[model samples]
Target: MKGMFNQFGGQFVPENLKNALDELEKEFNTAVNDVSFIKEYEYYLKYYVGRPNPLYYAENISKDLGGAKIYLKREDLNHTGAHKINNAIGQVLLAKRMGKNKVIAETGAGQHGVATATVAAKFGMKCKIFMGAEDIRHQSLNVKKMKLLGAEVVSVTTGTMTLNDAVSEAIKYWVDNVNDTFYIIGSAVGPHPYPTIVKRFQRIIGDETKIQIMEAEGRMPDYIIAPVGGGSNAIGMFAPFIGDENIKLIGVEAAGLGLKTGKHAATITMKQKGVIHGMYSYVLQDKEGNIKDAYSISSGLDYPGVGPEHAFLDETNNAQYVSVTDMEALDAFLYLTKKEGIVPALESAHAVAYTKKLAHTLQKDKIIVVNMSGRGDKDMDTVLKYLE
Candidate 1:
């Protein structure tokens, strides 16, 4: 029960890694409560990662839709160009506190890898970034950035050559080097301590929003929307407001091609309960429990499982989970860039896609917040190919 989201999360790993995980858990618990540790964390957040980015009102898009006024949580403006830096910095600090000299991570869409490399470079830790070969191709810019940040990029050409496989390889490496290496999981998925740890670090997104929104709107927002891949950004943005029943929460998933065509990453929408990458959650598996390869135009959304907490949330209806097609995401990507002069990462575009649809049908007096998770400079090549 210590590691469960109503039967959705657990250890689920081999016996050998349990002690290491336990140690990490103990250290993490101690560090978060230590006043000096928290001060150091907050210091890096303010000066390095740039906290309290912005909650800008998208006045143009709001007026154009003729519906709810919209606000964009500008996570894209954070250093390293995404919200991934929040957890990256936090976990790397834990690694440092543990006296670890190295860090390992798995990434897709490359934002997490870039963020990991950034902090590792800053803290002078040896870093290894395991990424799917396919993602390496699509997200070459971030791969280059990670290399320039002094990380060794390991290319995994395993199953599907995607995020799921990359995660598999990274975990294998952690298993081999568990004694000395600190694994910084990029999302709110993975085994017990990992999900809890990631959320602890990432909750800054929602915590800041609570204070910022009240200052701006003088009350809570009518709704908040964010994309869920392994559920990091979505949970980070939704966790703080979950108990407030007056505010609505929406989690958008990538429906690549279409859900009907069976080529999407809408795990909570289409998958059944099962274990994936050491956590019990909704996974894209068949009757025999064989995980299917998930497809998405956005590399970040191309995962076969939803985070356990997200599966639990979907089951209990604590928040609404919805789907948006890749075409819809592309349209939203272009729309936001043209309308708001801000380019959203393809992953964030899924949330924007659904937000546009919801906002168009709502009354003008309403308010909605969309977490713009990252900038789009790294996706220009993909967008160009589509335009071609």
Candidate 2:
């Protein structure tokens, strides 16, 4: 499984950080396979985080398309209202076991920050979240929620004042407070153990989907579609089936307008090889290799870079990526909410919009599963104004 990942998933850090990465790798390996870890994780999954979110067959939308059959892996139903909690709970438990008393993280849409703060409260650990000043404004409710949870929300007003800037600030904090602070990255985009660890935590999405599909339809899905932000939800859904070879994995990036419009967040689709956040990855950058500001209707997907693992998968032809414009994504957001009675987050609607397009191209007998990565509660105001 790891071989399919190539150079994209390798550890890329200074010699000084090698030991920490090694320790993290060890903890991840143990947490993933240990019996005690499994038991504890299951307890949280059932009671705290909520697992096995329903695989709801969207007959209405599928029939309306008159193409492939459609189903939703409802990660939106999980506790704290998104898949972010899964990784946050798992990582927080690990931090507690490691004797860490403080948790630090960076968030974009504030979903991950809220999840981290939620877990920190549960674990009674001090929590701090770094967010770009721009993001803090857009996701102010999340900042308020974090404060209510007793977590500090530090606004990063540096370069571009967005996700990457917030991440850089978090890294500086981690460097200064390494002993007592555990940096819990929001997605699978970071270096080494983070990509591996976050992917493992989110892989339950795929695991549950596989079983649900078999029981519900007596077969695996023909294609899996997920929105790509830091690429956690997409990679998580793709990882369990990486070796299957038959399951087509599709990642949808946010194209704010169009790729050529130069206002999109289609990193893998429009960007080139570059390094960012201590890893070699595909970054939305200029000819001089300077990272450019990214735009998306979904703040979560408004990142200027993609996970290295995703870059590798794209290069190796193991997965395919495409883009959805803000208009199309918004259309799908309303389509699902009004038609299916599910208010999907704009981030997740990127996947929905792509799936709707793909559905038209597929046979009616084919099955497609889309990961509903989050709920629309956080995006209601933005979406309502778009409708207005």
Candidate 3:
């Protein structure tokens, strides 16, 4: 709960927005402890968002990996078909409780946007999503999905026309219309309260995993793994076990080509210190501190900068960070679908790939939990084309 400003979570918004952030922080802090708030939130999580998603043991995958046990935290089964829904529902409910009438957000692969739109419909609030022009083209399916749910998706044409630009545009929108608008950032990577807020919402993954592990193995997992884009999924899977010394948290980043090839989204794994989109964190940057371009087959993981909490975690050694290239991730994606009958999102496949590599080093009795952050149905076209 300490101020993480030094690690990229301080006030970075305009003066007019500072008061709103303060109010939001206050509300979030109070809501965390309020019994009625907790109960209501859990109710939505259970009935509306589908809580306690199954944790399945991949026996086939384990056998292929020399019998290294692999347990999947099936976040893909959550509402909206990804972990994004968890934070979206939580934030929308918070916005409603706070008397907000509008919700706005930025998204890349459109999963977050769709999830936000779904919650807005549930709460009957006006919703707007800002996406990069390029993302609109690559993620048109998600855009259509959002529109079907009555959310307006605006395309940002400036800058790189990608996730970062969409976020910048969303912030501008929020600034211009701050009174009744709530900007629901998709990841645990924004300035103050956001990293904390999103992580708290997504912590259900870890919470459920803890109980499942206790019930299944009679012991906690030796490690928890998830892919790191804006780091929400990874933080979600790690937050509940943060204070436990026995559990190790691992985050796999996208090494689009290879780390030295300078084309990957492996921010914390290879980047140096810099500031981007407001916070000081490890960024893929050049000598002038300008963010460098990043590439990844997974649209969700293609970012030049990582979440601030992830940077902090890497620095403090609270978690281990690894990177998997596009080829490696693709292979893992195919392997899971063929061997285990699970088609994993390319972003999530990065963690699965790492898990495969680490199987040789781990004892057969030791448990390793990987978050299947999303389903790969949206990426079937990309996969088919790649294979062709």
Q: TM-score: which candidate is best? A: 1
Once fitted onto the true fold, the runs of candidate 1 whose alpha carbons sit more than 4 angstroms away are none
Candidate 2: the clashing residue pairs are none
lDDT per model, in order? 0.93, 0.88, 0.87
Cα error, residue 113 of model 1, in Å, equals 0.2
- Candidate 3 lDDT score relative to the true structure: 0.87
TM-score per candidate, chains pooled: 0.99, 0.96, 0.97
Pick by TM-score: 1 or 2, better one: 1
Of 1 and 3, which scores higher on TM-score? 1
Deviation in Å, model 1, residue 332 alpha carbon? 0.3
Lowest summed lDDT across 10 adjacent residues in model 1 is found at 1-10
Clashes of each: 0, 0, 0
Q: Please give the distance, in angstroms, between residue 386's alpha carbon in candidate 1 and its true position after superposition.
A: 0.8
lDDT of 1 by residue, 1-388 (tens): 4589898988899888999989999999999999999999999999998898999999999999889989999999999999999999899999999999999999999999999999999999999999999999999999999999999999999999999999999999999999999999999999889888888888999999888888898988999999999989888999899868888899999999998898999999985988889999999986788999999999999999988988988888899899999899999999999998999999999999998899989988888999998999999999999989
lDDT rank order:
1, 2, 3
TM-score of 2: 0.96
lDDT (tens digit, per residue) of candidate 3 on 1-388 = 2347355555566689878888898999988899998898899889987888999998888877884688999999888889999899888878988999999999988889999999999889999999989878877789999999999999899977888788889988888998899999998776677888999999999999999988889999888889998889889899888767788899999999898888888999875987666566788887787778778888889888877888888888888898999999999999999998999988899999999999768779988899999998778878888899
Reference-based TM-score, model 1: 0.99
lDDT: the better of candidates 1 and 3: 1
